[model samples]
Target: MSLREACESGKFVVTAEVAPGKGTDVEHLLKDAAIIKDRVDAINVTDLQSSVMRLGSMAFCHLLTDMGIDPVFQVTCRDRNCLALQSDLLSAWALGIRNVLALTGDHPKLGDHPTARPVFELDSVTLLDVIGKLNSGVDMVGNELKGAPDLFPGAVVNPGADNEAAMDLQIMKMEKKIEAGAKFFQTQGVYDLDAFEKFMKRIEGFKAKVFGGIILLKSVGMARFMNKNVAGVFVPEPLIQEIKDAEDKVQASMNIAVRLVKGMKDLCDGVHMMTLGWESKIPGILDEVGL
Candidate 1:
């Protein structure tokens, strides 16, 4: 089923991330996509995730669709200006990619190519508004379009933000995205259920589906690195210790994901599993969670 259908059905949905390789070679990525095709409601193709350069999100998304997998093409504002952004949206629709995830993207300074120039002409909120305009059969400047694509747009939120003020800012931004036509949300990595539950309560009235982001922790060191560098991501002390004490780090990570996804079944509509290099482990997690 399509991602939109899965969300509208009110059944617990499952999605996974597929960050394409930096080069043109996609043999490994295609293999990974094939393994998880039947397990997920959709696969999110990241757009230069972390601001590091890679194959274009739109191209990989099309590749996934041709391989009989559903893709939520990620659009980042850091690389494209308004003209390029709108053009890509139309092109994506022509290619039969309807699901989209809008992100402001990471700063270039934080990526591998720090010397590269960054573009922030449009943030995530404005991108949602652009999608809304396109869906209405119009361009950004009010020009009529030949046809409007029925795009199911989504945005990201950071429910696991550290400070109360930062968390409040995230909710306020989420409200704006919803108003701008965000149909769903895929949140930042979630490690604390209590914090996530509180976030859900705060936004209980908003009419949007929430898919908790689950980034499988491979080791205590990995968790620590994210806590130090990644914004709005914190790996609790207990979880870190659990992985540190486990006999098999990979299996421990999978078990941790299964437990978290099971617990989140009642709190959110679905999960956006982000396994990065561990894409092969997603089918195992889904099977164990009985999805």
Candidate 2:
């Protein structure tokens, strides 16, 4: 079944992300895809995730589709203008790629190539508005399109933002995205269940499907790095202590991920695991959680 159908069925859906390598070698990519293909309802192909230059997300999605895996093509606005974005969306639709996750993308400075020019022709909110217009048989500027795309578009949310008012800001953004034609939302990595619960309480009236984000940390250093460098993501001291005290960082990381998933099972419609480079451990994480 399609990711849309799986999510709308009220089932506890599971999705994972795959970051294509910088080069053309897709051996590890395919292996990771195969590992989670059966366990996840859909797979997200990250578009140059974290501003690190890599293979294109659309090509990765097409490859996943060929492997019989449903892929959510993650489109970022950092590198493309409306014209290019629309052109790629048309290509994705023509190639049978249905699921799309629109993002404003990380600033070029955060990526590997810091000198690259940043493109902010449109933010995510504007992108969603464009998608809605396209669905209605028109482009962003009200130009008529030869055909409309039947895209199951989704958007991102940062549930871990530190500001007391950040949650409200996020909910407001979500409402706008929904009005602009977003059907589902997958959040940034969430480590605090209390924060996430609070965010959900504020948006209980929205009709969009929400999938909590879970990132698997390989070590305490990694967790610390995220806590410090990644905005809108906070790792509680207790989790940090747990990681610091563990004898085996890898096993401890997996244990923490499983616990997070188990705790979030009843709180949200689904979980989107961002395993990063540790994608191989996903099966073990799912097995531990009995998912």
Candidate 3:
């Protein structure tokens, strides 16, 4: 079944991310794809994730599609204007890649190339509006396209905001995205179920399918690094302490990931696993959670 069907069927869908490397070689990408091919409902190919340049997400998604894997092609506005974005959407549709995730991506400075120029021509919210227009056979400027594209559009949300007001504002944005044309939502890394529950409570009436994001914490040090550097992601103090207290960090990390996935299964429509560089460990996580 397609990711859209799997999500709309009210089943707990499982999706994972695969970052194409900085080079043209797709060996690692295929290896990681093979690891979770059967386990996940679909694979998300990140677009220059973290603003760092790499093999294009469109190319990687096409590669995955050729290998008979369903791929959610992630498109970010950080690198493309509406023209290029719309063109890419049509290209993806022509190639039989249907699932898409729209993001306002991290700023260029946050990535490896610090001196790179930034582009914010259209934020994610406006991007959603653009997609809506395209779906209706119109371009961004209100001109009709020769042939419109039908995309199963999705957007990103962050439930781990530090302040209640900020969290509430994020939910408001999510509602707007759904109104604009978002069929589903894939959230940022969620560590606290209490926060997620609160966020979900506010959007209980909305119709979009929500997939909670779960990052596989590699170690206590990794957790600390993210806490210090990443925005909108918080590793709860207790979970961090548990990792810090473990004698076997690898086993501890795996246990933490499993518990999070199992616990989140009942709370959301699905889980988007961010294994970071540890894609090989996904099977173990799924096995532990009985997924």
Candidate 4:
């Protein structure tokens, strides 16, 4: 069954992501995906992740579909205008991809190509709105279409916001995205389970299906980097110290991920894994967590 069907059936879903490289060879991406294909409900294809130029998300999603895997085709508004965005959605549907994750991508300045122009023609909310329109047998302007896409659209969320005000804004955006037709959400990496639990409790009324995000803590440095640079992601110092003190760092990282997954058992609809480059270790994490 597709990821949408899995979630609708009240199954606690599991999802992961795979990013395309700047160059043409996809052998590595495919091999990694094939390793964890059966373990994940769906695999998200990143769109020029971090705003760095890379192989197309749509193309890789198509490849996943051809390989009999369900792919969450990520569409970032930072690279495409509305016209192009709608066009690409239809193209993706024609290519047999159903799941989509809408994102307002990072700025090009944060990427390898700082001089490239950025396009914020539509943010995540607006993009979700456009997807709704497409599903309803029309384009963004209310024009009729010969064929409309039956896309299972999802969006991102940041549960570990820095402050109360930021958390409030995140909730507001989550509601707005729901109104705009977001059926599910995959949040940013979270470490503090108590804070994440509090955030989940506040949104209990929405009845939304949220997949709590998990990033394997590779090292103390990685945890610190995410905390200092990434917005809405806070890695508590205790967890950092645990990584720093570990003699077997890889096993320690897997154990940390296992704990995070176990913590979300009663809170979220599922968990979304963003393992960075540690994709092959997912099975071990899942097995350890008894998922």
Which clashing pairs does model 3 show? none
Query: What is the C-alpha lDDT profile of model 2 across 1-291, one tens digit per residue?
Result: 789999879888888999898999998889888977888999999999889999999998999999999999999999998899988988998887999999989998988999999887987888888878887899888999998998889999888777868767877888888888888899999898887888888788888888999998877888899998998988898998988898998898888899889988978888999998777888899999898
Ranking by lDDT: 1, 4, 2, 3
How many clashing residue pairs appear in each of the predictions shown? 0, 0, 0, 0
TM-score, structure 3 vs. true = 0.95
The per-residue C-alpha lDDT of model 2 at residue 34 equals 91
TM-score of 1: 0.98
TM-score of each: 0.98, 0.96, 0.95, 0.98
Please give, for residues 40-138, the per-residue lDDT of candidate 1 as tens digits: 999999998888888999999999999888899999999899999999999999998989999999999878899888999999999999999999999
lDDT by residue (tens digit), candidate 3, 152-222: 88999988877878877887889889988898888889888877887788789898999999998887778
Model 1 segments beyond 4 Å from truth? Answer: none
Q: CA lDDT, every prediction?
A: 0.92, 0.89, 0.88, 0.92
How far is 98's C-alpha from truth in model 1 (Å)?
0.9
**Model 3 residue 52 CA deviation in Å:** 0.9
Model 2: which ten-residue window has the lowest total lDDT?
161-170
> How far off is residue 4 in model 2, in Å?
0.6
lDDT of 3: 0.88
Give the poorly placed runs of model 3, Cα more than 4 Å off. none
**What's the true lDDT of residue 42 in model 4?**
98
